[model samples]
Target: MRFYRQFRAYLVRRKVWEVTAYLFFGILTTLVNVLIFSVAFRLLELPWPTSNSLSWLVSVIFAFFTNKLWVFHSGASGTRSTLWTLLKFMLVRILSYGLDMLTMWLIIDAMHGNELIAKLITQVLVVAVNYIFSKLFVFADSNSG
Candidate 1:
């Protein structure tokens, strides 16, 4: 009971609910990506690489909206603010995706680590980077105007 209370208090104090929401929506976004990939590649007979790229594009757009509205509750109004936020979000995601790929390469190829373990570790790092980027840079300048 004491631990639970302490954990709850910490969550509230640190606004961890935003992280929780982000994760939930992130999972949904991933599922959407996978589904699109499967449909495009397996069902529609599209090339695998093309399907993968399309899925990634769709998922990133979905993630941006969900993270902005549901997770961060960004108050930056106006069309310019929205477009600027989106550009920043895309830039940060691109950087983090590169970091994730590099982490995987270092862990798996250079270190001879197991593929699944390397991917899991890379994902953790990616999530931390993404959260920090989203919070501190991407959605940080909302003026509610």
Candidate 2:
């Protein structure tokens, strides 16, 4: 119990708690994306691109709220400020979506790779990219203006 408390204190002191929370939520978001994609592509017999887009839509919405409330703890209030934050978040995510599509196209269409494999790989890349964008631009304190 003491060791656990010490470790927890260290994590907080080092500001790793925020990252740990982000990673936890990021995993959940990824699971949501992959599950939605799998259902749309395999069960519903949708095309890879369509399935990918559908999954992206759902995951982005999930990510936004989680990131705001938990990950970054933006604590942004007011209708205008919150809406502005949402808009910026969506814009950056749209850019990442384009990257996702391009990566999928290159892997599955051009390289003749497996669609599921392509999606998993794309998710890894997209998650990293999104984290950077969220930290630097979307959820950044300066951008709160």
Candidate 3:
């Protein structure tokens, strides 16, 4: 009960509505990723994994900038710190992306479902995983990069 009060105060003090807004931006970014990958893979005859990675790389840049400026409103860090943040973001995402691929591979290749359908399911899960890590880990502040 006491801990709950402290948590509520933290949220209120920090204007946690801003977090919600950031998450909304994340949702849009996720849509952008899916759209890019789906179009490139399905319509443009690009390979599935290739399209997925390329889309993620592009969207990560978008997500990073928005998160730095709007979500956390983090002050400018030196180049090393900025690079570290991006590195951490990529490292955190690697496992989640791998899991997404495994799931899609299992669903589409093993189970013989549609690849596009499997991608849709994986996209939803990956977006949530990324959002949590991006907020709590990648963008976390520290004296050391």
Candidate 4:
């Protein structure tokens, strides 16, 4: 309980703008992911998993740059630090991508391939998971300024 309070206070002191900027980055990536996935699947006749994986790959490429500059602001003092940070970034993304795949599977299989609904459902679930993981794990550093 006290930890949660301290965390909230830390966020507030850092300025809500930081949080807003991070959210905006996530929203942009999610929009692109869903747009590409839906368009490719519905109009271009791509398979569900194929479209989902491709869209996620595209979003991840964009996310790497955006998060480095905006979300984490990792000074990354040297090439080694940069590489280390990117390793952590990629690790976080591995889990995020896995969640995305699993969510799509549930939507497609368990929910019966109602694509319109499945796309929307999986997008929401994956975006929330990505945001929480990115903020709490990927971009978390005491000196991430």
TM-score per candidate: 0.66, 0.90, 0.76, 0.77
- Give the lDDT of residue 142 in candidate 2: 35
Residue-level lDDT tens digits of model 2 in 54-102:
9999999999999998788886788998999999999999999999999
lDDT of model 2, residue 11: 75
lDDT to native, each model: 0.74, 0.90, 0.75, 0.75
The runs of at least 3 residues in candidate 1 whose Cα sits more than 4 Å from the true structure, single-residue gaps closed, are 1-14, 96-128, 142-145
Leading candidate by TM-score: 2
By summed lDDT, which 10 consecutive residues of candidate 2 come out lowest? 136-145
lDDT of 1 by residue, 106-132 (tens): 875789776446545655676678878
What's the lDDT of the predicted structure labeled candidate 1?
Answer: 0.74
lDDT of 3 by residue, 25-45 (tens): 778778878888888888988
Which predicted model would earn the best lDDT? 2
**Candidate 3 clash total?**
0
lDDT of 4 by residue, 4-113 (tens): 66765677678774566668887898788888898888888999888888888888888878877876676665888777877877787878778777877887877677
For all predictions, the C-alpha RMSD in Å is 6.0, 3.2, 6.5, 6.5
